[model samples]
Each structure stands twice: as structure tokens, then as C-alpha cells.
Target: MSDNVYQKLMRVQSKLKAPKNQFNKFGNYSYRSCEDILEGLKPLLKEVGAILVINDEVVNIANRFYIKATASFISIDDGEKIISSELAREEEERVKFDLAQLTGSVSSYARKYALNGLFAIDDTKDSDSTNKHDKDNITSLNNENKWTNPKLTDNQIKRLYAIAHSKGVVAEKVKSQVEKQLNKKVEELTKAEYDKVCEAYENIKVANS
Candidate 1:
């Protein structure tokens, strides 16, 4: 397949420079945050006629909460896209941090790494490192995941029901939503599908007590 879009992405990857501009006081190291990656990507995206989107979701992997960040770079012309995902585990205990603060911190780190994978920004190296960028010698290729996605775990479904119940929603209504949006029973939904419904439920925006 002639992927001109992939070439455009390579162009962005070779040129998009995200320097570690922020200093970490406690760690005594300079690191770039998610905001820094976005600022660097915005102009290059415009230059290549592409758009980048990053989304975060809370997921349980191995009974621990993780922030799953998925980043996509898409060509405006053909909708061809390159996608990358990175997961950051939430701290088991965060001192002086509320639930929201802890989640936000993990989400930022995950998002930054997701963008890094998409744009080939290596944070391990110093801001100024040798290795002439891959502008001239670029090859086009396709990227994807071939594994069959697993269905939602039992705990996830229960959580969904728990959300609806807490929201004053009826069991029948929850069942109806599962069948209507998914066209199948909740038991048949995949993890990604479950996240779709879970995100929808979460979007309801509960008022903080």
C-alpha cells in the first residue's frame, strides 16, 4: 500500500522536538510534561495537515488502577492514522494528594509517554543528543495490533451496574442501554466496548459531595 500519510507522519516524527524543559525539584532532574509534548506537536501537525488526539481512561490491570492513554496522529486527507497507547499505574498511596490529584498526575505521565511513542521522542537522552534525525531516509509502513481483544472482566460489569444504580437508574434501563448501544448483552462486551460504556457513564458528571 502506498502510504503517503505514513510518510507525512515520519516527517513529523523526525522534526517534532520536545525538549525536557521542566525541572523536577525533588528528583533533581529536568523532564517534559504532557503539556510540553502537545505544544511541540501542534505546529508540526498543522504543517503536515494532520491532527493528533490523546484520550485517557481509568482501567484496572492486575487489580491495580492504571491510566490508559491512547494517542493518535491522523492524516486529514485520507484518515490514515498511527496510534500508540501507554499505561501508567496509579500510586497505591499518595501522601497529601486526594483521589483526583493522584489520578491527574498519573494521567499526565501516561499521556506524555503515549505522545512520545507516536512522535518518537526519547526522554531518556539529554535534550541535545547526536543521531541526525530521520528526515532524508524515511520508509513507509503499516502498524496495528493483531491479537483478539478479551471481553470485559466480571468486576467491570458489576462496576457499571453499580454506577447506574448509584445514579438512580433502574436495572431495566441499564439493561436496555446495554442492548441498545451494544446490540448485545453486557456479558458479551469486550474490554474496549466496556470502556466505551464506562466512559459514557462516567461522563454523567457526578457532583462532588
Candidate 2:
């Protein structure tokens, strides 16, 4: 009997070890981001003939906002896929960030944990679990713009897609073009890049009018 996709993925997951590549000065601790996990899993995924994909959706429940990130592993030879999801709430009051930034932060956090669940990555000693004082300081620093980026919200992304579709432009083509021009994935695009993409799409809509 041939091993299924889940078994093959488990084999890869057993060898995956994402090291802490970032340090928080305020917290005086090291931590791993979603990017770090993805980086570490790249070679392992290739070795196992699997592809990893991540996507996010925004949810509102009882006037509270949450970001749900879904991570999936797909077998290359067979089309079998395994998926997991995790949700993070928008810490609007705790963190002095705009709605978009809050959503992005929550999305990233959810994505990290979702991937962790899929890969069984143990985060027992991570900064979130330790260093409460440092975490508070880090939150303060984040509000001061010491570490934060402007990002697009789920609504913004949907608006962009709607504009592209209305202009008879393929949504995927526009996304690919923006990613190629900015040299980053749509999800990873910075605030400036996101604004630029939106502006370009707006221009297209205007020109066609």
C-alpha cells in the first residue's frame, strides 16, 4: 500500500524545525514569524512533493472582528490536500493600530499558528508564553511605529478584485502583475505597494469609462 498524502506530510513535518530568526529588544527574547516557518518548510515541502498554501478570511461576530487563516498541504502527485485553520482577534484597543494593520497583524498571527497546527510545531517556550513584561513593552513600541507596516484589509482586497473584474481584467492577472511589479505576494505587499496597486486599478477603471 502506498503512503497517503497525510503520511507523507507527517514525514516532512517530523523533520521541520523553524529556528527563531528575530529578536525583540524590548522583550529580550527571540521568536519565529510565519515567514520563518514557511522558509524552513520550503525544502522539506519540496522533498516530500507537497505544496503549501495559506489564505485568510475576515469574520465578524457580535461586532468583534477576527481573522481566520487557513493553511493547506497538497500532494504533487495526487491532488489530495490536508488543511487546518486558526483564528486571531483584532486587538484594536490593546494595540494602537489602524483597522488594516490590526487585521494584518491578526492574519499573520493566525497564519503562523495555523501552519504550526498543520506541522505540529511546538511553541511551548515562545515569547507569547514567556515574558509578559517584555510583551507589554513590545506592544507599546509597536504603537510607536517601532515595528509595524501598513497593510490592506480583507475588504480592501475584495474592493480591488471587484474593480479589476468590473474593468474586464482578470483578477488573477492583475494580482500576478502587481506581485511581479512589486516583487512580493499580494498578501505580503506593503502599504505603499498596496496603495499603488489600487491606484493603478483605479486608473484602469477611469480610462475605460
Candidate 3:
């Protein structure tokens, strides 16, 4: 791929940061797969003249499988050993790390790493592009999709449950307790706001059904 494209991909990847509790959400988060990291990178891919492709191989270790993502810069020179998807795998927590990396496209934090391996993503768009794919011109398709609505995962829910049950939201301790348990920058959501989000999701489900 062109240096321009590679740079853009790196910028995008660097921006990826995993949430405290990632993936593992029920409802559309699991089945529809909307809040997808790859989907977020669609515009960047088209802009940079690169295509990100993923492949899979099975390992004989029982229920083991390997997934590889290849980011091909269409403009790369033949002799050059351009970035390959094979480099994406990390050993020693190989399964867990690879799985996290592969699914990063769906999770907020992990997507950054995925983009790093796949494209030339630059945060500073002024010098990176050839005036065709400037940052301002690139539309964020991430906002248009249904799955864009992010929610806490099962792990996060459990953490929240534990905090709420253990401390029972004593006046001064709620904030610290939540932050410690959830590992998220938590704020007290007003009952109205919380109810609204829940009701809106419920309405969405009913409408879709």
C-alpha cells in the first residue's frame, strides 16, 4: 500500500482502546454485530486504496482456530515486504489476544490495534492524504448504523451488580466503588436518563420484532 494509506491505518489503530468489559453483550450487540470496528474503518479503507481481509486456519488443539487479518495496500511495491496479516498474531496468550484483536473491530479499544496492523491511519490528516481523502471529507459511517449504540457487557454488568449489592450506594462511596469495580469512568446517570435509554432500547426491540 502507499505510505499515505499505511499512515492513515496506523492513526486509526492507535485510536482503538478497549472498554472495561468488551464484547459479550446480549441482544443486537451479539447477534446483529453493528458496533463493529471494521465497519468503522470502511471509509478509511476506501480512502487509502487498501483492503483489509481476514482469513482463518484451524489448529489441532481441540477447539482451537486461528484468524488472520490481512491489510493489503493495493499500491505496495512487489519487492517490499509490506505489512501482512500474519503479523497480527501475538503468542503466549495467543488465543485470548488474537481473539481480542480479531474482535477489536467490534469493541471500541481493540479496534485501534486492528487498524494499526491493517492500514496507514494517521490522526493528523492534513499531511497524510493526497487531498482526496482528507479527514474532513471522510464520513463516519460508524454513526449511521443501528449497532452504534454501545452498552456494558456481561462482565461489566456483573461488576455493577457486585458494587450495587455490596455497598448499596452509600452517599459518598458510590462513585469510587463503581470506578474501582467497573474500571470505567462512571458517573451517576440520573434516573430519567437511565430510564430513557432502557425504554428506548425496549422500544427498538419491539419495533424490530
The lDDT per prediction is 0.65, 0.68, 0.35
Give the per-residue lDDT digits (tens) of candidate 1, residues 144-186: 4232222444445677887777776666788898899779998
Give the lDDT of residue 68 in candidate 2.
72
> Model 3: per-residue lDDT, tens digit, 118-159?
543332221211111111111111212221212333333334
Looking at model 2, residue 94 earns an lDDT score of: 46
| TM-score of each candidate structure, all chains considered together | 0.56, 0.60, 0.30
For model 2, residues 151-182, the per-residue Cα lDDT tens digits are 44444566678877877778788778877787
- Stretches off by above 4 angstroms in model 2 are 130-209
Error of 3 at 133 (Å): 35
Runs of candidate 3 with Cα error greater than 4 angstroms are: 1-5, 14-35, 61-209
Give the CA lDDT, 0 to 100, for residue 141 in model 3. Answer: 19
TM for candidate 3 is 0.30
Misplaced by over 4 Å in model 1 are 1-3, 126-209
Model 3 scores a C-alpha lDDT of: 0.35
